[model samples]
Target chain A: MTGLLAYFVFFATIATIYAIIVMGLNIQWGFTGLFNAGVVGFYAIGAYACAILTGPARDTLIGGFGMPFLVGLAGAALAAALAGLVVALITLRLSEEYLAIATFGIGLTVQLVALNAAGLTGGANGLYGLPRPFWSLFDSVQAFNLFYLVFVVVIGLLVWALLARLVRSPWGRLLRAIREDDVAARSLGKNPVSVRVQSFVIGSAIMGTAGALYTGYVGFISPIDFIPILTFQIWAMLIVGGSGSLLGGVIGSFVIWLIWTGSGTLLSRLAPPDLQAQSSAVQVVLIGLIIVLTILIRPRGLIGEKSAVSSKK
Target chain B: MIQAIADGLSTGAIIALGAMGVTLVMGILRFTNFAHAEYLTWGAYMALAVLSVTGLDAGQTGPFRFGLGLVLATVIAVVLTVALALAIDYLVFRRLRGRVNHITLVFASFGVALIVRYSIHLIFGGAAHYYSNDLQIAWLIGDGLRVMPDQALVFALALLVSVVLFLFLKYSALGLAMRGVAENPALAAINGVHFRKILFWTWAIGGGLAAVSGVFYGMTVQIRPDMGFQLLLPIFAAAILGGIGNVVGALFGGFIVALIEAIALLWIPAGYKIAVPFVVLLLVLWLCPRGLFKGSSGGSK
Candidate 1:
């Protein structure tokens, strides 16, 4: 029972973190018509930034700033937003494919910087033993699980409410318009580039916050942690849960995480001991299959975009 | 240095091979096929299988052990890659045709890339393997600057392939139809050019070239799933930097990216090797998206 609870807690922690990341991506791609394939870059920055600020000395490469957790999260968000702004300003003006190229390039540069600037990021070993909220008061594993769950749920609700408002407002309509017809929006005196950069910044900030929560929960941040695979996974979630939907974003995370955990557990039991070492990779491949099959069948996703009610409850 | 020049040329040759696939798909189909790297990875794995299948691992010698084995591997990789590309077109891309927007297609390609890469991992464990360098005996020159027989063979194949491709594209009827479709699909269709047929062929040719590049790349470095994936950024960088639709431009861009990647290793930390291609791509994209060559009208906005 305790093992099951811990596994649930662990998977829930990652799913909540991924929900925020996917929501951020939804804002950029689903709303603003920007294709940012380098979402992991911003996520990593947020994670490493907060990790460095709150980390201890000696073991810390760029850690030991000793800043409070929330403050570090804010700084991380701001940094990611700024990076998004810079990249958007440079490449958002380009067409569809060119934009993809630029964003992908930015992702590589971020990975390189994180890997090379070992003094700041602890290099490949990754930052470990991160301080979690209320970690001190909780002596048992179950207690810590409940504690982090509250923190994650609260943050998730706040993000959900805020994004819901943004999607419903006039800015949201403007975003839809831009996505539908860029030239037409430009003709109406709306600066598509400026709006895109704005959306990119805000979305990237959300991604950073997700990263902050990820670091605090997992208690580690490394260059390897924020690979392109994460970007692909987030995208898969967004697609599976119905892009441009608030409830979908949250629900998608839980569904994908459940499948990942359940399938992994089942496969480990079936496969030989030697092959079990590669189960994580097998899980990754399954995720890819899910994305492809899901996209091919239902491009809008499971929940999909809500339609008007006729005689519904 | 002559050594750097040789290294750059060989590196350029491989990139040129990879970039051809990227350029063809872009010119003909209109979205960057991000899964292009999977072809290279598949080739390397196929080569491994060939070596194991031929049972030449113990004490086999002679030109056939090295030469024929490599050739058979390339052929197998090419066949597999072409069929796979054709399948992707038939399955995902064809359905997406005339239905979705451009950004939708781009995201779809990403989905395909994710699927293909993970499938590779699933089929072949994510471990790195290498072909023995015993056959890679150096030929001539003062220092370790001499070309190995295998390296010379790869360069020769690249040169031959490009020449033949150019001739085909310039002289053949089907090639002309493909070029026409790229120029203006509506007009080409009015002229009775079969649009879908051209796209299928483009995927095949592109996949074959990608496999060739993969074999050469694996011969130089160890074969790992991420090897082809890591090269993707540079491959696209070469495509866009060379001018998206221009074959010759891709060749030059390939060499430029390879030279920069190799030379950057001299100064930067080894971990930053992946960043070199993007840096060059960014420079080219920022300064001259048109690049050094005159691009086909289809590539330009």
Candidate 2:
């Protein structure tokens, strides 16, 4: 049916957006061994930035530049990269635990700001009517959705190619070297801090791009969309797929998203109407279980790391 | 200003109790237990569950809102929370110990936190619960300042527990073994210290303290599934500010963080109170990475 086709297109488009986010996480966490617990922060920045740039002019709200789609995307990435740079510079020198806590706090702080800063972020209601890329060209909703899906796929491929090239380059090797052992890399005259900063910024920018793409596709943006759970979901995707592998990150995104959406649908149909609200809690529990089981059983994940980055003590 | 200080002390007491477990786990386990906050939630909920079953949540004991029934429920909750912590360790963490990297453990803890928090959410509906609906008059302590008797009780009990814990760690053999392992795991193992025993006791004490804090928090504030999570940042800030491994420092840091948050309300909106701990945490991490305390044998390395 046309309905099924449309749903599939929508699902694939969202999944691809998540894949982009996962790939970004892979760069910071998988490649650089940086525990960025604040994926949502950069993500929120991107979404808000894009919404402000491309959205129609509003008297109450801040920016309504009505920029081109690509310009909005670029602005999102820049904003996210700036945030990533600040976070990395401050917390990268600390222990992994400290970095994790700091990032988590930062993520929460971003959410708080979004909730409070009414004029800028349109408060909790959030900015709506975001201009979708090439939306006006299509007559039907389905046609537009299909067109957007193709556009997203193309962007996804472009990102993949860019990341693939970067990882294969000398700079990518340096990231891996630093990840494996920062001291050894430092001894080899490689400045691990600067390299980590670069990776963090790039990864954050990619997350921003993903956020911008999500805003463009969904046609709305809100603070509620960038909760800590979003970060956790991306983490689950990366961990399940395989951290160090780009293919694994992409696969993990689809797999996890499928399971997440499938569980929701299944739960809605199966559970009684009264208990429907609690079903989300069940889904979260499942996510938590998957994370635990995967870490315990398959630390390397399903696809496993292509490189010989030692996970063992 | 006086009211703010009073509220800060009460909040600090709760944070200190919660941070105690975190700092200990970080010291001995060498990983931040993100799930530790869930213990507080579980503790509060467990107490509520017990009270609801017994229909003992209504009675008020003199000036305080909670009665002997709540106290009994708290004891039961402490035991249950300890069991929960140990069970989690046995099932998940114990298996992953030294097998994976510290970051992996941290991620696992995140998962664990989500599981525990949502499990509480699934069991208890999203609605907030209270131990007693009884109204108590706030005691006028100073000029234009009001302090609740429950706050005083919570502060006293938290201080009492902290002192007892400090003394226990200083004098007790098992506590000494735990400290030894925290300081130098290899050396302690070589010296015939039972690492497993220390780990067991660490969880026991941590869980027990967390339960008390949770109960105290529930007694003062409304009990919600997400209360533990809301408190997580402040607790971490306290622990880090005090120095990660130092128990006394965590206690001190908790009060300092709480006081700052409370006083900052004079300038900033109350909604921004959540950001206060994060700012303190950032400042501490930026300025004093080792924390305000000079020496703590455990996590400083």
Candidate 3:
């Protein structure tokens, strides 16, 4: 029973971290109408930044600053925001599909850099020994898991509260105005490009925070963690949860992560031993089908966008 | 350098075919079809299936190292892939045409791409498979440069088909109708061109072209389930680096991008070769958003 509880806590912690990432996506894609197909790229920057800042010395890699966890988190977010600003400034002029493709390319480039830059990223083996916060307070594995879960949940709530407030602010309305009709916003003297870039940077910082949180909990970072499939999974969660709603982002992460893990366990139990290895591939197919089905059945998502000022299409 | 150029040309030929199909869909549909590359994967698998059933893949050939069985399989692949493309359109994309915005359609296509790619993975189990297991030595053309007959055959076929395609677009009645529809759908519809027929024909031609490329690609390299998805970035770069919806431009874009990828290995580590297209894409997008080509033939003819 304790083991099961510990597992749930572990799962919830990861889901909460993903929830933070989803909220970041919501800010960019849902709020500002920026089609950022490179969520994992910014996430990766954050993870690597934090790992490099907070990790212990290693012979092969360039890390070993051994900084405080909070400082590492701040540096990670800053690094990601800087990357977002540069990328957005370069590619934000392209409309819709072009923008998506450009961002996806950026994501791939970042992943490639992480994979091949052995001296900096520790190569494909990944960086390890990143410090976790408040490790001294916990004695047993269960206690540590429970403590981490609370820590992540608190961070998730703080992020949610901040974003919820931001969406209701004037800046949020401007984002929607630009999204619904860019020309109208431009006519009203709003610099849509500047605003869009700002939102992208902020959203990227949030994703970076999530990545830092992930590194804190997992204590390891690898290039594989930043694959395009991670971008797909985040998009799926946001699509399933209402895109424009903060509550939906959190809920969707938990629900989708649950379905993802639950299906894995269920498949392991039901499938014969010969086919157990193939079940993960089946799970990917299932998630993909669910994405299609959700887009078809409920494009607005489960909770739906609860915008007060913006008119519906 | 000559060998690299030869390899680049052969790879570029396959990419040119794929990019042409993508440019077609982007022109007609007004959305980048992310799932278009999966048609190539399906086409390769279709050819593999035909060969396996007929025992033709094992058959021997002459100097070219290709057999009559492979040709028959390619023909069969074209038909099956065209059908698959049409079926997917009828089931998913047709419904999405006027209902949602283009971005929504793009996300839907992303979903479709994932489904198609992973379904192939589930069926094929992720192992790499080749059309011909026989290895042929490259004939020496120079001191260092050698050319494979298969590579020559693939490029020649690609060039021939591209010429035919260009002529068809320039002269044929259906091609004129397609151009009209791409330029202005409402105006084309008013002028007695059936929009649905044009859309169907677009997919048919695109799928058929993709099958040819897929077969050639499988001939050159091993076909894996993820091959289509991995190739997608380069294909997109080719289409965009050439102007979107411009056939001639996409052809040039393919060769340029491939040549760059081949040559970039001298400067960067081989593992970073995957990023060459992306760097080219970012540069092109930043400096020349309209592409290097002068024609912006989309929607205005």
Candidate 4:
């Protein structure tokens, strides 16, 4: 029972993390119509920033501020926002599709830099021995996981409330107007560029916050942990949950990760010895299939849009 | 120095062939088809099947040498890749055709990429495969230079194919139609050009070229599921650097990308070779998205 309780808490922590990242994506792609495919880049930056700030001075290449986890989290969020601001300046003027491609390329470049810049990052090996949120107090895995999940959930709910507020505001209305028809949106005295940059930077900062939380929970960070596929996975969770819906994003993350974890465990029994080496790989393929099938059958997702016209469309 | 240039030329040739496939589709379809790399993987498997089924891969140095083996392999892979491209067009892409939004098309391509990559994984067992070749045939040619015959053949083939594609795009009625479709589909249709027909041929021929690049790549490197995927960013970087819909730009971009990947090792770690193309991609996107030469000619004429 305790093992099950610990596992649920771990899973909840992950779901909270995805929800945070997806909220950022939802702002860009779902609300503002800017397809920021480089969500992982910002996420990774946030994690690294937080890790470096609070992490011990020995393993780190720089930023041995040796600050508290809270301070590190704030710094990570700021850095992510700054990075997003830079990327947005380069990409926001382009078409949505072009932005997607550019964002993807930027994400690749970020991952590459993360992998090669061994001094700042730990290189391909990744950074370890990170200080968890309460290193001085919480000792057990379960206690830490429990503490982190509650902390993350509080943060996640706060983000949800903020996003929920933003989309409903006049600013939210303007974003939707742009998504539906950009030319029309521009005709109404709204500067699409500024709004896009704003949404992108803000959402990216949220993703950064998630990254900080994720790093704190895992107590390690690596380049391998931020693959291109991760961008898709978070996107999938948002899609599966229903875009433009904060609650849906959180729910989707839980469902998708559960299936992923469940399949990883179940596949071991059916997989042969030779295939065993590639079992996790096989799970990845299944996830890919899941995304494809889900999109094909239910474009809006399980819960989908509530409106009849939108849902039908 | 001369030998490295020769190898670079060979690598450029292979990349150009892949670029042609990508650029042609991007030109006509009006979306940077991200799944194009999957075609190269298909081509490798196609050639592998032929090599396995009919012991035809082995040959002596004649008119029908590795060159001929390549041509034959090219034919099989191209045909299969074209069909696969069409299947993707019909099954996944065609449905999303009217959606002019790039990311939507990207989503569709991601689906196609997932299906193709995993299908290849299911079939090829995710392990590396190779054409049985051990003959290095490296020779000294004065002033610290070396040449490998296989690399030479691959480059020669790359050159031959690029010229043929240039001519095809230049002279043929089909070529004109393709340019028409690429420049402005609505206007091209107004002139009675069948966009779908041109797209069909483009997908087929593009798949063929991607296959050629794949075969040369497998010959030079190793055949694995991620082989084509690993090349995705570099190929797109080249295509973008070359210009969105320009063939020559794709070729030059491919070479620049190849050069960077080749020489980046001097400064960066050996493991970070892939980063060279990606870095070039970011720089080009950040600095100059219009190809160094020009762009798709606007096909305005």
Candidate 5:
């Protein structure tokens, strides 16, 4: 019973981390109508930042400043936000498709650097032994996991509240206006470019925070963790949940993670040893099918845009 | 240096084929199909299945791996890929058209790409397959430069196909209709140009060409599920750098991008070669958003 409880707690914690990412994506894609295809890049930057800052100092590489956990988290958010600023400045002027491609490129570049830049990123082997907050305070693994779950839940709630408030504000209204029609928004004395940049940075910062939390939970960082597929997964989740709604982001993240983990477990149990490796291929195909089906059935997503209905009535 | 150029041109040939298809689709459909690369993968794998089924993997002909069986398989693969492309359009793209915006289509393409890529992986098991495993000694031309006969074949075929496609597009009535639709779909529709037929033909041609490129790419490099998807960036870079809808621009863009990649190996480590297209894309997008060509319409306007 305890084992099952612990597993649920662990699962919930990871799901919450993803929820954080989904919410961030919601802000950029949903609220601002910015199509960021390279989400994993910012997530990777955040993970690396936190891992480097909080982990013990290394001898051969540039990272391992050994800062506190909060500092690492802050660094992660700042680094991702900075990267977002750079991407937004360069690609925002172009149309949505170009911006998507450019961002995808940026993500790929970041992954390449992580894989190849041995001196800075520790290369493919990646950095390990990232310090988890308050790990030493707890006696048992279960206690520590429970503590972490509660801690992450608190942060998730805080982010959710903050984003919910932001999305309802006048700033959020302007973002939607810009998203719907940029020229009209511009004509109305609103600078869509600056506002988009702001939203991109903030959303990226949130993704970075999720990365930091992920690193803390996993206790390791690697280039393999930040593949383009990660971006696809997040997009799938957002699409499944509904793009423009914060509530959808939260619910969608948890539900998708549940499906992901649940199916993974089921696949492992069902498939024999020879076919087990191919199960991941099946999982991805299923996810892809889900995405296509969702687009077909409910392009607006499960929860959809709450603001539109509320404002219409 | 000569070897690098040779390699660049050969690779550029394959990229050009893929880019031309992509550019054509972008011109007519008016969206960057993220799943375009998957057609290449499907073509390669479909050929692989044929090769395996026929037990012709061992066949070699004329100082190259261009066996008769593989040749036949390539034809079959082209038809199969074109059918798949048309089916995808009928099922997904056709339904979504005019209902959703282009960005939604883009995302849908992403989903489709994932489905195709992983479906290939599920079947093919992620192992790289070669059309011919035999290694051919490169002929030393001069100045210690070596060139493969296979590479020569790739270059020639690419050139042949490009010219044929160019001529077909220029002279054929359907080609003119395609160009009209690309330029202005609504206007073309008003003028009684069959928009749906043009779209189907464009995708068919694009898919068929992609199949050839995929087979050539598999022959030169190796066919993995991720092969075409990995090359997507380079293909897009080629298309955009050449100018989105311009076939000639795509052809040149392919060569330029490939040449840049091959030569950039001199300065940066080979591990960073993947980022070269990205950097080139950023530079192109920044410096000349219209691409290197003028009057080649159908971009993010």
Candidate 6:
């Protein structure tokens, strides 16, 4: 029973971290119609930022500020936002496809750097011994897991409330207006580019925060953690939840994560031991099928956008 | 330096073939098909399956590493790949057409790519497979440069395929119709061109070319599920650098990108080679957004 509880806490913590990332995507893609495909890039930047600032000093890497967790979180958000700003400035004025390609490249580049730049990022092995917030305050593993879960939940809820409020604000409506018809929005004397830049930055910052939270929970960071698959997974979550809907995005995160973990377990149990390594590919295939099916059958997602501002063809 | 150039030329030819398909699809389909790269992987694997079934992959044909069986497999693979491409279009993309925006289509293509690539992974395992393990000595081609017979043949075949495609698009009735549709679909529809027929031929030609490229790549390199994805960015860079819809430009762009990557090995670590196309792509986008050969003949513009 205690094991089950611990597992639940662990699962919920990861799901909630993903929820935060989905929320960030919701703002950029769902609300603002900005297809920032490099979610993992920003997530990595945030994770590395937090890890470097709060981690103990090491000989092999550049960082080891030993700052407080909250300060590390702030640094992560700032660094990710800055990276987002640079990408946005370069690609936002171009076509959506250009943005998509550039962002994808950026994500790949980040991973490559984390793999090769040993002095800065500890190379492929990645950084370890990351300080979990208030980890020392707990005794047992279960107690720490429970504590971290609550801490993440509180942060997740805070982000959710803040985003919910922002979506209802006037700026959110402008984002939708631009999304539906940027020309019309432009004619209305609003700077669509600047608005998009703002949205992209904010979304990136949120993704970074999620990365920090992930680092905190996992207590480790590596290039392996920020693969293109994570970006696709987050996109899947947003698409399954309903892009423009905040609540839908969060719900989609949990639902998809559940499906992801459940599929892995089921595949392990069903597949022969010899083929266990290849079963992960099957899970990827399932995700792909889900994305295709959802786009075909439920373009608006499970909990679709509010009808008033729902995208009209 | 000479060896790198030789390798670059062969690799460039392969990329050009892939890029041509990408450009054609983008011209007619009006969205970047991310699954297009997977067509390369599928083509290679399909040929592999056929070769394995025939037990022909084990034997060598003359100076070349491949055999008569590979020739037969190539033809079959082209047909199979075309069918696969059309099937996917009918099943996934055809329904989404006109129902959603181009970005949605792009997203769907991503999903399709994942499915296709991973399906290969699930079936073939992650380990790399070779068509033939036969080793041939590289020919000394003056000034300490060496050229493999396989590379020479692959490059020659790639050029032949490209020239054939160019001529087809220039003179063939179907080719003209495809160009017409790509230029102005509504206008072409009004002018007696069947939209569906053009769309069908686009996939057929694109998939056929992709199959040839994939086979060439597998012959020279190794066949793996991730081969298509590893080459995805380079192919896209080629297509975009040549101008999105321009075939000739894509061909040239492929060579340029490949040569740069080959030469960049002198300055940058080989581990960072994957980033060369990305850097080139960003520069192209920044310097000339419409590509170097926009409004060229044989494309939409």
Best by lDDT: 2
Going through the candidates in order, state the TM-score of chain A alone for each one.
0.91, 0.97, 0.95, 0.93, 0.95, 0.97
Question: Total clashes, candidate 3?
Answer: 0
TM-score of chain A of 1: 0.91
The CAPRI class of candidate 6 is medium
lDDT of 3 by residue, B37-79 (tens): 8999989988998998888763456768678888899899999
lDDT of 5 at A129: 84
- Model 2, A1-313: lDDT tens digits are 3788889999999999999999999999999888888899889999999989999989998888899999999999999999888878888877868888988998999899888888888888999988998988989889988888889899999999999999989999999999888889999999998898899899999999999999999888888898888888999999999999999999999999999999999999999999998998999999999989898988788887775645544
True contacts kept of each: 0.61, 0.78, 0.68, 0.27, 0.80, 0.68
Worst 10 residues of 1 chain B by lDDT: B57-66
Against the true two-chain complex, what DockQ does each candidate achieve? 0.59, 0.77, 0.62, 0.40, 0.79, 0.62
Give the per-residue lDDT of model 1 (tens digit) for A265-303: 898899899888577777787777777777778877877
Candidate models: Cα lDDT each: 0.79, 0.89, 0.85, 0.78, 0.88, 0.88
For each of the candidates, the C-alpha root-mean-square deviation to the true structure, in angstroms, is 3.2, 1.6, 1.9, 2.7, 1.8, 1.9
DockQ versus reference, model 6: 0.62
Can you write out model 4's per-residue Cα lDDT over B32-102, one digit (the tens) per residue?
A: 67788888888988888787787776454642236456567667777888788888888777766774355
- RMSD of candidate 1 to the truth, in angstroms, is 3.2
- Leading candidate by DockQ: 5
TM of each candidate vs. truth: 0.93, 0.97, 0.96, 0.93, 0.97, 0.96
Q: How many residue pairs clash in all the candidates, one count each? A: 0, 0, 0, 0, 0, 0
**lDDT tens readout by residue for model 4, A241-292:** 8877777788888888887778878888888878875676666676666666
Tens-digit lDDT string for candidate 5 (A1-313): 3878988998899888888999889999988888888999999999998988888888988888888899998999999999999888887877778888888888989999999999888899998887899899999888888999999999899999999889889998999998888999999998998899899999999999999999888888899888887887888889889999888888888888888888999999999999988898888898888888898888878889865634441
